[model samples]
Every structure is written in structure tokens, then in C-alpha cells.
Target: MFRYLILIMILSITLAGCTEQVKVDMQGAGETIPTGSTGIAFDGKDLLVAKEGLIAFIDNIDTATAGSIYGYEGHFYFDRYPITITSKENKPYITGLAWQNTAGNTGFIWASDEANRRILKISPQGDVITRIPLTKIYPEDITFDGEYLWVVDSKRKKIFKLSTEDGSIVSEYLSPVPVPTALAWDGKNLIVGGLKNLNNPAPSPDNVQIIKLDPVSGNVMENVETSRYLTSPAGMVWINGKLWISDRNSGKIVIISDKGEPSTDIRSYKLPAVAPVLKKVEAKEDKNKTAQDVDEAKRAAEEARKAAEEAKKAAEAAKKAFELQQKK
Candidate 1:
């Protein structure tokens, strides 16, 4: 009896070790482009992509309005162009998008509205459900980890933990990278795609690494280097136990395993004839450009330029302050 008990314990330990082991194979994977693919979400059938203000479908890219499989025959069954929400008197500048099944009953697409500093929850059919306001931080990428929403603020260099029910920030932490751009949640780790300072633009050949973090505390766990395959990895998603990342500058969708190994059967697909729908908002001014309007426009441009500089300085100051507090 004693020998049988010892054998069972040994077998259990071996099985547990095998289940937790990960193999990363990013090399040797076939590379493909999804045409300006930024943020990606899979709805078990088709992949949903986030553009400036429009959503595109990975399977049916040609469909102009119907970017999601939920779309009806032709018209976009989900949200349409000219997003109803506006910020700074302009349309919300959408950066990232994610699809979630609420309570396992309703479907919601959460968009990171950088311009407005908020996250918009809309129905697949383009109806506004509610807006979650996140002030001061420029939200770039977002992901859902079962019960909570994790958002990375690019300018602030912080990862915010938000309540899935109301969007209120539960906690925030300084990200390991200075310019964190994308986020993906594996069952066990929070993967962050980031770059060094945006001010120092690195050449394409420069190797970069994505950091994995402790999901609960947002502490750096490890950095996985993508020496050859990923160039400027931006938006990322975990699908079928593999991490799919979109390279902003390269315009390629890269697939890699948890261990950073490329998938063997990597494949690429041709984008449909219809080009991506670019957001074009006509100026609200009258047809004739009056001298006063022209002068006002010039003045406004100058103010914007100065304001941008000031904002950058303020962001840096805030970051330093936060870091000091963390040290304490």
C-alpha cells in the first residue's frame, strides 16, 4: 500500500509539470498582413479589428459597413462611422478595441477612446451602452482578464486596473516600459508590448522585448525578446494558446507561442478590394473662408503647438512624482 501511494504522488507531480510548461516558437512562422490591423479581437468565428473610428473584419475585409460577423446582409450591423461620441469637440480617437460577452449573455465591444480619455461600451450593432470615463491618462490598449479590465496609458506609463462593471479604476501601477503600447492577457500572465522612449526612434533592425507581468500586482515577471519576427509589436491578443501581435510600422500580424517561438504553419491572407474606411470629418465652418476664420485658425494652431509641449512636460512631471511615491 505504501509503494502504491508513493507512485500515485509521483505521477501527479509529473502531470502538473507538463500542464504548466510552455513552449515559445516565433521563428519559422509564416508572416501576414491584415492591412492596418491595430487592435484585434476574436469572436469565435471572425476577428474584429479596430481602425481609426471604424471596425474591420478579418474574414470579410471587403464589407464596408459590416466589419463584424454580426453585421447583417450589407449594412454594418454593429457600430458605424462618425462614432456618436466626441471629445475636444472632435470624434473620439479610437486606439484599441476588445469584444466581451457580458455575464455570458450580451456582447460588448469596448473601445479605447484616447481623445476623450474614456472607454466606450457599444453593442455589436453600434448602439451606445455606457461610457467609462478615465481622466488624465491617454488610454492606448485594453484587455479583459475574466473579471476586470486592464488598460495601459501610453503617455502616463501606467497600467490601470478597472472594474468591469463600472469602469472605475481599482488600482494603477507604473509599467515596466516607458512607452507601453499594447496588452494581452494569457490565463496566467499579463503580457505588455512596449518600446523605449518614443522620442528616441529606434531603427527597424533594433531588437525589442515584451514584458510579462504578474497579473495581480502588475510587477515585472520577465522580458521576452523578439529579435527577428516582431518589429514594433503594438496590439496583441491571446488566441488558441498563442499570442498574435500586430506590428504598427511593419503592418504584419505575428504569431508566437508563450515561449516566444513562431507558429510553424503561419499563413497570410489578401485584404479585400474595399480599402479600410478612413475617418473623414468635414470642417464645420461655412463654405466661404472669411478673413476672421482664417486668422482664428492660425491662432488656434499656434495654441495647440504650445499646449502639446506643455502637456508633454506635465506628463513627465507626473510620472516622476508617481515613481517617487512608489519608491516610498
Candidate 2:
């Protein structure tokens, strides 16, 4: 009888293991342009790209707008007029660029000056608004989430929320990635990228390891992956619902299909390398997370699941209300 009970227990354990869900690793694909720049931004009208000391404005591009499969835009064209930024000290090594086309800001951009440890508020037309100095932090890729500037610090492996008015640090969070690279805002959450970890080979959810973060608490959320399509997740920007990312070394800009498109036809573009890189700062090595840290991560994920369900319920309610009104 004892031997029979042991055999049943073993069988049950095997069945339970088989029933456990595994993460589905999915990624997108696209070709890229070797522009060797590591910055991507849209200045209301034109897509602005920058590297070491030169910034280029892409006025027109056969940018992929709609597609289900990853694009092969081998036959595409764009117009670029280079804008040279020269100074007596030295040429600016622009690591990142960000611009949100809002009221009163048409041509202005926020760029990372790696050489001087500063962020420059300038425009494509060669006008300077202000220069915010970073005491120690190295600014990598940057994104304007409508109100505040989100900056990535590669040396510390962290992301910072900075004040656009004065470049003051509002808040900071440890990047989910050990070797953090780029950042982008997807209407609601912040998407951060990193070097491919061959050891893990999968993100929290799965794939090329791009992570999404909570804007308020800086907590990490599930994010999209670049598959094997992207080499370096360098510079990223949200355009027309897709995440446009750059591979720094390969000089290829990779586009990822996101919210603005149907998942049935999701796509991003691989274009000219136009962005620079995320500069590092002097900082201590990263430490490992404790048990408490793991617990907090689990709680954050649970909260995210609840929030998503609530959002879905609200959308359904709104749709039903519209239907009732139509019947009336």
C-alpha cells in the first residue's frame, strides 16, 4: 500500500510539471540602415537623427506605416540635410536625442552631450535654448513622455526622470537590464532596451528583452522584444504607433510594431543608423536583488494584471453604453 501511494505521488508530480505554462518567446524582424548614429526623434514634422557631432533631419521617408510582417523596405528613399554643431571647446558627442512636438516647441530638441556631461536644448535650425549640466551621470538615450524627460544612465544602469525646465533629477530607478541601452515612451509606459543576454536568452515575458516600466514608481512591467533582428538596442522613439529603435554599432535603425497597429500587421522599420549611444558615468557595480526584491516584483506583476483587467472591463462597459444609446 505504501509503494502504491509513492507511485501515485510521482505520477501526480509528473502531470503537474507537464501542465505548467512556459513563456512563449516571440520577436519581430526587420532590415536596417548602417548610419552609425544612435539617436532618433521626431520634431513635429521631420525625423531628427544625430551622432558624434552632426545631426541630420530626415524631412521625408518612405517610412513603413502598415504591414503584418516585418518590412523589407529595400527600395526606400529619404531626404537628409545635415546640420553641423561646431564650438571652440570640442565637437559634441551626442549620445541621445528627444523631442515631443508640443505647443510652442516646433523645432527644438533635447540632446545628450556625452563629452561635457550635459544635456543641450537646441533645434535643427541651430538655435540654443539652454544647457543643463550633469554633475556625474552619463546620459544615454532620452525620450520626452509629453511632460518630463526620461534619461538613461548606462554607467549606473539606471533610468532617471529629469525636469525639462532645469534638468533636475526628479526620480531614478534601477534598470531591469544589466547592460541598459535605449528608452522610449509608448503612450502609457516606458520601454527600455538592453544588450542581448545569451545566458538568459529571454526577457521576463520572453524574446529580445526590451522592458516596459511604470512611469510613476519606476517599477518594471512586461515589454516587447526585438527578436534577433536588432544588434544594439541603442536609440528608440515612438512614431505612428511603432517603436523605432537604433542599433548603434551596426548603424541600423530597427522599427518594432506596437500599439498603434493591429497585432495582425505589426511592424517596425530598419533604416539608416542615425543615433549615437548611451554614455556611461562613474558608478559602483550593480548588486544582486534579495528575496524581498523578488517579492516586490511579484506584487508589481499582480497589480499590473489587475490593472489590465480593470481597463478591459472599462472598455467593454463603454462599448455597451454606446450600443444601448444607439438602440434608444
TM-scores of the models, in the order given: 0.58, 0.61
Worst 10 residues of 1 by lDDT: 263-272
Residue-level lDDT of model 2, residues 102-154, one tens digit each, is: 56765468888777788888865767778898895888898888889988887
> What lDDT would each prediction earn against the true structure?
0.66, 0.68
lDDT of 2 at 287: 28
Which is the leading candidate under TM-score? 2
Candidate 1 regions exceeding 4 Å error are 1-34, 60-88, 103-106, 205-207, 227-229, 260-328
* Candidate 1 to truth, TM: 0.58
